[model samples]
Target: MKGFIEDTNYSIGLLDDTATPRDVIDNYIYEHTLMGKNAFFVADLGKIVKKHFKWKNIMGRVNPFYTVRCNSSPAVLEILAALSMGFACANKNEMSLVYDLGIPMENAVYTNPCKQASQIKHAAKIGVNLMTCDSETELKKIARNHFNAKLLLHIATEGISGEEDMNMTFGTTLKNCRHLLECAKELSVEVVGVKFHVSSSNNPQTYIHALSDARCVFDMAEELGFKMNILDIGGISENEAQLEELYQAVSPLLDVYFPEGSGTRIIAEPGSFYVSSAFTLAVNVMAKNVIEHDQHLPSAGKQISNKPAFIYCMNEGVYGSFARKLSEKLNTAPEVHKKYKDDEPLFASSLLGPSYDELDVIVEHCLLPELEVGDWVVFENMGCGSLNEQSPFADFEKPSLYNFMSFSDWYEIQDTGNTSESLMKSLCVPCFHLGEDQFCTV
Candidate 1:
C-alpha cells in the first residue's frame, strides 16, 4: 500500500520536473491540445469496451448487454452492437440509440419499469422483444401499445440508490406477481422471465441478493403457471468480487427451474462494469485559485479558516464522469491511482475536481500528497469513469470527433482517427507549456 499511496508532499511536480499523476500529465496534453483553453471531457467510450468484453468469457452463459442509460455515445453504441451484444434501454431516446446501433430487435430489452405511451410505442415500432413493468398500469400500457411485448416485472434491490429503486417504483409482490403473470397469460404476452438489479451500489451480496431476487421471481413465475424461459439480471458480472457468489446461488436454479423445453436464457446487462476504467478523461487546467474566508473570534483573539483553500478548476466538473460526486454509493469509496515525485512524503488534506464548491470536494481530511494546478486525476477501480450522465456540455458544440486543438499549431499530429486509444496517446503527450516546449518535457 505504501507503494500505492501518494501521501501529501506539497511541491506539485510540473512537466519536465517530476512525475505527477498519470491523469495530471493527461490533463496537460489535453489542455495543450485545446490550445490551453481548458477542455472539458466527453467520455472515452472505447476504452472500457475493449478491455472488459472478452468474447469467450462473455459468450458461454448469461449474455451481456450494454445499459443505454450509461454513456451512450454514437461511436460507443456502434462498437457495442458490432460486438453482437444486446442493449437495455430505459426510454425512447435510449431505445432509438440502440436501434441506431443496429442491434437485433430481439437483442434489445426495455428495462425501465415506468414509461410514457410514446416510449412503449417506439419500442413496439422497433419490435422490442422484451420489456419490464412493475405496476398494473405499466402492464396495461404495454398491452395497449406493444401487444407483442413480453415484460419482466422489476423488483427492488432494496436500499439501492436514486434511479435504481425498482422496488420503490416497480415490481409486484408474490400476490401481485401472480396477478401480473395472469395478466400476461390473458393477453398472450409472454411473462417468460423476470429481472432485478443487483444492488450494484452495495458490496458483497448486492449481486448475490439480486441473484436471489431473480430466483424468487422465477419461482413466482413458475407458480403462476407461466412457463418462462429467460432471466434478466440487470447489471454486470464483474468489478465487484461477488460474481462467484451470484453464479453459485443462481446456477443450480438453471436446471431446477428451466427444464429443456422450459426455454429460459440468462441475460446480464452492464453499464459501468463494461466501460469504466477503459479510459482516462482528458481535461485541462481551466483556472486555479485558493479561496479565503477567516473566522475571527474577537474577544478570544483566535482566527481559523474552516474550509481548506487548496482548490482546482478543471474543464470537467460534476457533470462528466465524476457526476457520481453526489451519489453515496459512488462517493462512499473513491479510488485514486497515484503517481508520486519523491519517495519520502508528508500527508496533507487532499481534494480534487474542477470546482471550488463545498460539496464538489473529492477527498477531505485524507492523508494524501498535495497536488496543484495542471495536475491530472483518475480513479482506481473505476466502476463509472468520468463521463457522468449530468456532466455539462460545451457552451458551444463538441470538438469534431477527435479534432481537439493543441496549444501550439506547430506540433504535428498524425491522424489516428477518433479512437479512445489514440485520444489517450494524444492526452499522454506533454504539449502544453506557457514556456517553450524545448524547455519542458514530461
Candidate 2:
C-alpha cells in the first residue's frame, strides 16, 4: 500500500493496521521529552476525510465552504481542496493560498463583510467575483474596486436569549438590506444572495425567523430585478444529532422558500466541524508552583483542612495555541501524559502560559495529579482556532505539526477516485517517520 503528502518537506506516516493515533502520540511525546520537549500537534488527516463523508451523508444539500481563518495549515487546505470542497477566504493571504492550490476561482467566495480596498482589488485581479457586502460603504467600495463583482448581501440575525450576542453585530438589518440592494442596483453590481450567521446555541425558532427574513429580502430583491440564487448559512453544528435536528428545522423552510425546482444554492461555513477533532496538541510543563491554602468548612464546626493548590505553567498558552480562549470559552481539559494510579490523590491545579502576563492563564481551575517540570500534557479537539495564532509577544514558537493517516484511510481515498496525482503522488513506507527534524519510533 502507498500513501502520500503534498509537501515533500513533510511526509505522511502511513500507519500499519494495528497502529493507532495514540501510539503515534506516545512515540512523539517520548521522543520530544527526551530531546527538547517542545510542544507539538499530531494530526490525523484521515479523520478529515471521514468528516467530509459524514457531511455529505447528513447535510448533502448544503455545500461546505471550508472557512480558512479557522485553521490555515497547508496540509489541511490541500486535503480539503483535494476533496473538491469550496473555500471561504477572509483575506488576501487565504485567497492566495487557495488559488495556489489550483482550486477553481468559482469555488472560492470572499466572505469578509468588511474588506480592505486593496484586497478587494486583489480578488478582482485574481478573477474572484463573488464577495460579501453588508453596507453601502462596502458595496460602493467594491463597485469602485471591482467593476464585475457579484455580491452576497449579509443580513444580521437576532441572538437567542441567554446566548452570546455576537450575532447582533455584522450584517445589515432587513430594512437596511433594501437600501443596500438599491445602492447595488445603482452601482451596476449584481446582488446574488443573502448571508447570515447563526451559532449552535441558537434556538430552532431562530432559523425559522432568519429564513423568513431571507425570503423577505429575496422578494424585495426580485421586485428590484436582482437575481438571488445563493443562501450562505454562516456556521455549522459540531454535533451530528444537533446537525440533524437543525436540518429538520431548516430543510422544510428551504422547501417552502426555495423549492426543489429553485436554482438557489445553499452553502455553509464549516471550519471547526471538519478539523477540530482531527488534531491533538501536546504541551510540556515548563514550571510548577504549589501554594498551601487552608479550606475552611463551616459545616465541620469551623474546621480547616490544609492542602496544596498547584499552579502549573506550560510551554504554550493563550498567547499561542489557546489564543481563541481570549474571546471564546474552552471546556476541553488536558489529560496528564504521565501515568498515575486511579486512586492517586488529585490537587486543585491551574494551568498558565509561559508568559508572565496575568491574562495568559489557560485553565483557571482543574483537578490534576501532581506533576513536575518537563512532564507532558495532551489536549484533544484542538484543531480549530489554534494553529493560526499571530502572537505579538516575543519568543513564541508555534507547535510543530506531525501529519499521518492509517493505511486503510489512504486506500479509502484511493478507492473514491476523488484526488489527483499532484495531491498525493509519492509514498512513504514507514508508519512513524514524518521528516528529518521529527521522526517517531513505535
Candidate 3:
C-alpha cells in the first residue's frame, strides 16, 4: 500500500509513510493524464467504520440501516456489509444490489413509500417483506402485490420551515394516520410500525415533534389491533453534534412513548452522516481564461471594485459528480493543491465544468490563486449523492476511484516481524467491478 498500487494499470501510490493528501494527488497526476477525467481520492473504509462505531457509541439503542442511496460504491457497501450494517434500500435495484452482496433480506427495509408495482412484486418474490407506505393508494398497491409485507406508515413531520423543506412530497399526515391504519386492516396489510423523517436540515425539535406524532400513531395502531413494534426515526443530521442534539431531544421521549421492554424496535436510516466526509473529488483544470471587466459586455461600462475574474473549465461539473450542487443545493468551494507566492494576491474566479450547458458551472465566485491548466482543485465531503448521478455526457469517461486506508490491522503486524506473505493473507482490500463504467480500488 505504500508503494505503487499493484493490481491496476494506474501506478499511482503513496510516496512514503508520511505522505500527505496533496502528495497522493500529485503522485496520481504524475502517473496519469487528466486529459478529460476527474478523480476521487476515497478515504478508505476505516473512516466509515469509525463513523459507524461512533454512531453506535452515541446512539447505542438505535439500530442504523445505512442508506444505500447516498453512496452505493460497491467497495463501500462491501465494507459496511463486512461490519454487519443493515441497509435501507429505496428501490428494487438497491435491494438487488444489497442481496447480491449476500446481505439477508431481514436486515433491509424498503424505506420508499412510493414504489413501482414491479418493484413491489420483485421485493415479495425475493422475500423482502419489510416495507413502507404513506397513503391509501400506496397501501392498496402493496396489498395487491404483497399483502403479507410488514409495513411502516410514513408520517409527514413538520419539517424545517424553509424553501428547502421537502415534507409535502412524502409521508402521511397525523390526521390521516387512523384512516391509513383502517385501510391497512381492511386490506389485511400488517402495519408493524411508524416511520417519519424531519428532512435533512431540521432542528432537534423537529425530531422530537416527529417522535411525538409517531407515538400517537403507535398508540392508534395498537388500538386498531395492529402490532406496532417498529419505530423508525428517519435520517436528519449529517454531523455528530446535530445528531447528539437529536438524540438528547428524542431519547427521553422514546422512553415515555415506546419504552424499554415495550417490544418496539428502534431503527434509523442515516445516509450522508456515514460517508460524506470519507471522499474527496479532485478535478483537473483543463483550461483557464482571465476576464477583464472591459473585455466582458456586462461589466464593460461599469467600474468594478474587484480584480479581473478568472474562468476555469474543469472536466467534471454539475452534470457529472457535482450534481449534488444543483440537486441538493450544496455550496462547493475549491481547494487548490498548488502553492502560492507570499506576495501573490488571490483573484475572484468562476469554475465551470466540461459541459456546454450554462448550468454546468460549479462555483460562481470564489477567490483563488491563478492556477495552471494541469493544476488540481480538490473538493472534500464528496461522498454524498455523487458517483451514482455520474453520466457519460460529452463522451467523457467517469473518474477512476482510488480507495486508500489510513489504518489497518496490517500496520500493527508490521512491528511483529510478519512476512509480506502473512500480511497479504491478512489484508483485505475490497475492490470489485460493479459495471463497465464503475471501477473501485480499496
Candidate 4:
C-alpha cells in the first residue's frame, strides 16, 4: 500500500481547479503588491509566534522562557512580551531586545554564561537579575563586575563538547561547583540553580536524561550544603506530540525530584518548538528554466539516459532566511502540492533558492508537487523552525508570504505586475488585516 502522501492528488483533495497550493498559501498568508514587484504579504512573523505561545505546551507549570536567538524579529519579540512569556536571552543585545519592548527584566533570564563587560553591565543596569555561570571564573567575573547578581549554573551536555570541552569549561565539575558554592557563600553571590540543554535531538528521552542529570547536579549542590531555587531543564524540541511524551517522562521526574513544595521550579527554554511550523516561506521559483543534459554515467554520454535538470532559484538564500545546510535532516524541502495547471507533473523533488552562495538553497533536495515559471514555491522553513538558530540565519532575517492564488482579498492591491521594484512598496512588505476580508500594507 502507498503512503497517504504517496497516493494521487486525491489524497489532499482539491476544491476547485483554481484551488492550487499557491491558492492555499494565498489564503493563509497576506500579501501586498508593489508597483513592479509583488510584495506577497509574506508573514506576520508576530502572529505566528503568539499562536504558538498559546499552545501552553510548556505546561506553564515550568517557567517557559522564549529563546531569542530563534527568530529575534522585533515582530516576534513584541508579541512574546504581550503574551507575557519570559525570555531566555543569550547576550546583551538579546536582553536589550526585550527591554526595548518594555518587558521588565523580571520576565527574562540570561542564559549565555560567558560575556563581555558590556553584557555584564547591561544585565546589572536592567536588573534582569538572573543569569548563568559554567565555571568558577565566570562566577568570579559576575561577582566582581557588578552588584549581587543571581545566576544558574550552565552545566555541559554529556559527551557533547569534546575535552577542553565546555562541559568542564562552562559548568564547574560537581567537585568544582562545591568550590564555586564555597566562593559564592563567601562573596554573597547567588547561585539560583542548574541549567542544561538536551539539544542533541528532538528526543523526549533526552529531556528525561537531562532532568535526571540536573537532579544529580542538584544533589551535588545540596551535598555541598548549597540550596537551589530553580532547575533549568534546559530545552528540547517540544512539539505537541513530543511535548506530551516529555510531559509523561518529565512530570514524574519532577514529582520524584522537585516535589512541588520542595523549593525548586522547572524552567524550559524553547524557541524553535514555539515558533517552528507556525508559518511558511513562500517564494516564486522566479523561473523554471532547464538545462538539457545527457547522463554522465561511468558509461559516458553515449546512449543518453537524458534528463532535465529542474534547477530552481529564489530571492531568499543562506543570507536571506534559508538554513538549508544546517538542517540536513529538518531542512525545508519544497513540494508542489497543487499546481495552476493539470498538465504539470503532480509531484516532484525540487531544490530551491539561488545557489550562488554556499547552500544558499532552501532544500538541497525535495519532493515537490509540480513546477512552472513564476510559480510561487512555498518552503516550510519560514515562521518558526529549529533550523533558523544554526548560524548566519540567526542574523536579521525576513520571511514573507506571497498570496499568488487563493485568499484573493487579503491584499492591499488585487493585482500584481512584474513592473514593481519592491514587493511591498505601498505599505512596506507584510500588511495587517484591517477587515474580515481585506488587509492594509505594512
Candidate 5:
C-alpha cells in the first residue's frame, strides 16, 4: 500500500504549475483506466471557497446554509464545513453526515416540512432542534415528539413566470398561515421563524412577493405570542447575477420589516449557486458509429447530398451522474477534446450513455469534430444536484471521482492550523476515489 501510494503521489507531483484542469483530468484518465470504465470528476475547492466569500461580501446580512442535497460529495461538504457554513438538511442521513464531520447540530437546519415520526425523534435525540414545518399535523407531531424544538413555518409562494416552480408540493398557503400558527401556539411548540423557497427562478418579483408573504407570517407569529427571530430565505438563484437581483429586491424589504439590530437572523439555503460551476465531469467515449443520411432529388434521380451524423456512446448515462437531465430537465452539451485535422469538417452528432434505455441519450443534434473510441468528452456546470443522485445500472459500475484544488489553497488551509484539519485532510487533491461501490479518502 505504501509503494502504491508513493507511485500515485509521484505521478501527481509531476504535474506542472501551468496544468489546466483538463490536463489533470486527461492525465488521471490515462493513468487510472480501471478497464476503461471510469468517469472522472474534477472539483475546484478553491472556487467553492471563493463563492462563499463572494456571497458573504454581496449579501453579508444573510448567512448561508448550504443545501447538502446538491452534490453531497465529501469534498464539497468538507470545503463548506471548513468555511464554517451551516447546512440545510432534508433528512436524517444529511444531518448525520454533517454531524459526522463534527459540525455542531446548531449549524444545521432540518428543512423538510414533512418528516417521518422517527426522523423527528432522532433529530431531537441528536440535539438538532431547528426544523421546518408547514402543516398543523407536522406541528402536532413535533409538539408530541420534541416540544423544545425550534421551528420555522414554511410559507408557499406564487410561481415565477419563466422558471421551475415548487409551490405546489411544499409550503403553507397564506390563507392557512394564521391557523397553523394558532395550532403551534396551542401545542406549546416554539415557532421561531418563517421559511420559503423561490424555486431557483430568475424572476426578482418572486423574492419580493415571497418576502411580503414571509412578513405577513412574521406578523401573525408575533400576534400568536411567539418571538419570531429567524427568516430562512430559501435558494432562488442559478448564478451570481440572479442572486444579486434577489438580494437587491429583498434588501429593502428586510430593512423595512426586520430592521438591523432587531435580532432577526437572516439566512439562505443556496445549493446550485454555490456548486454548479465548481465541478467538471470527464466521461470516456466507449463506442462510436456514423449514420449517413442520403437526400435524393427527383429531377436528378440521384442522391445529391450525404449528411453523416456521428453517435458516440460513453460509459456514464442519465441513470448515473447525468440523471439531472431526466429529473430536472437539464440541457447539457458536450465539448469534445480531440486532435482534429484542419480540413476535417465538423458534423452533426449525438452523445449517448452506456445504457440500454433509449432515454440515456445525453445530447442530440449537436455539432462536433470527428471523435473515436477512448476519446474524452467534458461537461461543465455539473456540480449541482448530481453525483449523489447517481445509481449503478445494468451491472455497470459508477464512475470514480477525483477531487482537485490548487496546491496553494490546500497549503493555506493546512497552515491556518485550525481544528478543521481533520475534514480538510480528506479534501486534499490528487484524487479521492468516490465510486458508488467504494469510497476512498486521502
Candidate 6:
C-alpha cells in the first residue's frame, strides 16, 4: 500500500547513481524481518539497460531476439520491448506475451524446433511466420499448419572438446540439411535461412566451424532455388567481453562468406546474456535442525564440538526461485544476512525447500554461520530463469519482485532516443518510499 497503486503489477524503486542493488535488498530484508519473513527478489534494471547498450555497441551487426524461456518477468519483457529488441518465443504462451505487448508481428520468431500443431496455427493467425525447424516432421507440420511460414534450417554445430553432448541435441546434421531443404521444397515451404547454436564454451574455432556449416547450408538452399537471407548464429556468449572476442573472431569469416549487399540479415538468440547478472534473490530460513557428528578417538569416542551439521528448510526452493537447482545447473552459494565476525564458527549446511519432496534440495553442501528460524539468505546472479517459478504446494507462493534503477541509468535509457518518459510510465509505477519521482500508470 505504501508503494504503487494496487493495479500496478510491479513498481520501480529509483535509486541515486551511487546506490547499488545491495541497498535495495537490505531495505527489503529489514522490513520483511519485522513484518513477515517472506522470500522476494530485487532486480537492478539498470544492469539490464546497460547490457542492452553493450550488446548494441559490441555486436551491432547481429540483431538479438530475446529468448522468452530464460526469464519472462513482465517488467523485463516491457523494458526490452521498449528498447525495440526482437523476441524469440519458445511456445504459444511466450508468443502470446510478445503479441500482447503490441510489438509488430514481424519482430517475433517462433524458435521452438519441436512445436505443437496448435501453436503453429496460433503463429499463423498472428502473422508471425518466421520460425526455425530441424526435422522433416516439424517442417511438414509447419507446412500443413502454417502455409505462409518462412523457415530457418537449424544446423548442428561441431562441439568443442567437452561440449559434444550440448551440440548433438536439437539441430539437423549437415548431410541432412540438403534432404530437409528438398522436403521443404516439395512441401512448398519457404526455407529462407539457417540457424545454429554453439554451446557456451566461448571458443572462436567452434563459431568458425558453425559459420562454415551455415555457409554450406546456404549453398545447398541456393542449389534448390531458395534465396536465403537470414542467418541466425543461435545463442551468444555470457558477457559482452566474450561477445566482443567472438565478433572479432567471426567478423572476417562473415565478410568472406556473406559480405555486405548480400541481403543476408544476421541475428542471435540471447537469453542469459541479458538477464543473468541483473537480479538477486533473497530467501528466509523457515526451519533449522542441527545434527551432531561423531568422531572416534584413539582412547574414547568423541564428538566434533567445533562444527555441527545443519539442515535448513528455506521458504523458496527448486519448485520456486531455485528451480535450476533441480538439474544441478546453478551451484550458487548463499550469503548469511546477519553481521557476524570473521572468526565466528562455521558449520556444514544443506538447504531444502518447504515441500516434503526429497528432490526439493536447493543447496546440497555449504558452509555458513549459525542461523535461526527467521534469518535471511541472499543469492546473487539469479536473473536467468529464476523469477518465474511458483510453488506447487499450498504452503508457499511466488516470490515478489522489487525492481529498481539508478537515475543515471534512467537518463541513459532516455538518451537512447527510443525509450521515452511515456514508455517508462507504461512499463512500471514508482515507489514513493525510494524517490520523489511519481510514475502514474497510463
Against the true structure, what is each candidate's TM-score? 0.68, 0.90, 0.84, 0.72, 0.87, 0.89
| Backbone N/Cα/C clashes per model | 19, 0, 0, 23, 0, 0
* Candidate 1 lDDT tens digits, 159-197: 534354445545555446667777777776778777766
Q: Best candidate per TM-score, number?
A: 2
Q: Candidate 5 on 110-224: residue-level lDDT in tens? A: 9887898898888898888999998888888899898679999998888756555547688889989999888887888898999988765557787888888888988888887
lDDT of 3: 0.74
| lDDT of the candidates, in the order given | 0.54, 0.82, 0.74, 0.57, 0.75, 0.81
TM-score computed on alpha carbons, candidate 3: 0.84
Which regions in candidate 4 have their CA more than 4 angstroms from the true location?
1-34, 38-41, 44-60, 159-170, 202-206, 220-227, 292-307, 327-330, 335-338, 341-343, 346-352, 367-372, 385-442
How far is 107's C-alpha from truth in model 6 (Å)?
1.7
**RMSD values, in order shown:** 10.3, 4.2, 6.5, 10.7, 6.0, 4.4
lDDT against true structure, model 6: 0.81
lDDT by residue (1-442, candidate 4, tens digit) is: 0011111111111123333443445554333222222213233333344444445644647767888887665444544554567899888878887787666787788888677777888889988888888877777788877675887877666553334433444555544666677777787787778887765454665566566777777787677666787888676563567776677777887888889889787788877766665446655555464544342222222332344445566645555455534555543556453445656432223454454565565554433444665556556645553223322533323433322212332221223222122222322323323232233232
Tens-digit lDDT track for model 3 on 238-324? 789988888888889889888888989999999888888877888888889988844433332344446677899988888878988
Candidate no. 2 TM-score: 0.90
Model 4 lDDT, residue 233, Cα: 69
Model 4 residue-pair collision total: 23
- lDDT measured at residue 224 in model 6 versus the true structure, 0 to 100: 91
| Range of the 10 consecutive residues with the lowest summed lDDT in candidate 5 | 1-10
Global fold similarity of model 6 (TM-score): 0.89
Task: Give the candidate order by descending lDDT.
Answer: 2, 6, 5, 3, 4, 1
Clash pairs (backbone) in predicted model 2: none
